[model samples]
Target: MTLKEIVDKLGATVGLGADKLDREEEYCFASDLMSDVLTLKDTPVLVTGLCNVQTIRTCDMANLEVVIFVRGKRPTEDMVELADENDMILICTPYSMFKTCGILYGAGMKPLY
Candidate 1:
């Protein structure tokens, strides 16, 4: 799914990098554990409930771009700045991780498996 579609479908708040909305994400990975996230390939969209600088750092280390912060958890200013520096896309959704994953999956977004 496209970033714009995910945002619209999930009714997410685009916390950062609206300019990067045109990018397409083929796979989705839901995990609060940064260690698990490190194993992802294809720069899959991260569906997470954890919002912190470490989240941004994990994304950076994994070379991922798009992130969906579930349950309305948003990144801090410093995290946003770091993401901006890394050219990452940030989104916050009010839905739980399961709901968000279901929504995106129903929208034709594939799994990271």
Candidate 2:
């Protein structure tokens, strides 16, 4: 699904880079640890509870097109700026990590590897 679709389906808020919402997402990964995310061989739509500038940096290294912050964790001002600079789409969801991943997976979003 596209980032726009994920946001619409999940009732998520576009925290930043709404223009990039059209980017397509093939998979979703839910994790709080950057280290675990880094280990993923395939790039996926990252769903995380951690909200910080580091998330943007990790997205950069991972080449992640979309990031969904679950449980309503808002990104910082710096994080928004970093996401813009990195050309990443940021989203905020009210759902917890488990529910968010489950919903996406149930909707046929598989992990890329």
Screening candidate 2 with a backbone cut-off below 3 angstroms (N, C-alpha, C), the clashing residue pairs are none
TM-score of each: 0.96, 0.92
Model 1 clash pairs are: none
- Candidate 2, residue 70: the lDDT equals 94
* Model 1 lDDT per residue over 12-111, tens place: 9999999888888888889999999987766888899989999999999999888999998978999999999998999999999999989888989988
Best candidate (score: lDDT) = 1
- For model 2, the stretches where C-alpha displacement exceeds 4 angstroms are none
TM-score of 1: 0.96
Cα lDDT of candidate 1 equals: 0.90
* lDDT per residue (tens digit) for residues 44-69 in model 2: 88999999888889889988768999
lDDT per model vs. reference:
0.90, 0.86
